[model samples]
Target: MTTPVEVRYFAAAAEAAGRGAEQVLLPAGTTVGGLLDLLAERHGPALRDVAARCALLVDGVLHRDRDAPVGAPTRVDVLPPFAGG
Candidate 1:
């Protein structure tokens, strides 16, 4: 069985997801986009859209592509765009 990964959401993404974070067990070799899809299904449409526009982080490092590979028991963070002057 695959290990459970901890996914953290911030700002609007967190509110939309209705939770600060979640722990999920993904099949081995699952792509980052696949994981987002799973989260969208679990959190609902609002979060799904937010996730689409957000940046992803793995273990505190930015994730550049949806196809990036993530192992089990990883720490994933979803960060939405922030506005500032």
Candidate 2:
């Protein structure tokens, strides 16, 4: 089954994606890693590079495990590294 997810991009991530937010349809039980791959495919290498240095938040909570499953109707935030304190 396919599910809908909201992806919010921040900083360089937003620039790479060319938008601050978008909705995507993904297979049910797709992992965080899978989502990253899909995003890269859709947005190209710029986004892939930015995403590599980004921190992901799933449903408002930080998600570090790429293997973790991303459920339906979820919100994912991609935050790029910040230089200043």
- Largest TM-score belongs to which candidate? 2
Give the poorly placed runs of model 2, Cα more than 4 Å off: none
**Tens-digit per-residue lDDT, 1-85, candidate 1:** 6868899999999999999988888888877788888889999999999888888887777875789876664788989888860
Q: Tens-digit lDDT track for model 2 on 19-84?
A: 999999989888878888899999999999988877788888777678888776478898888887
Tell me how far the alpha carbon of residue 33 in candidate 2 is from the true structure, in angstroms, after superposition: 0.9
Worst 10 residues of 2 by lDDT: 64-73
Clashing pairs in 1: none
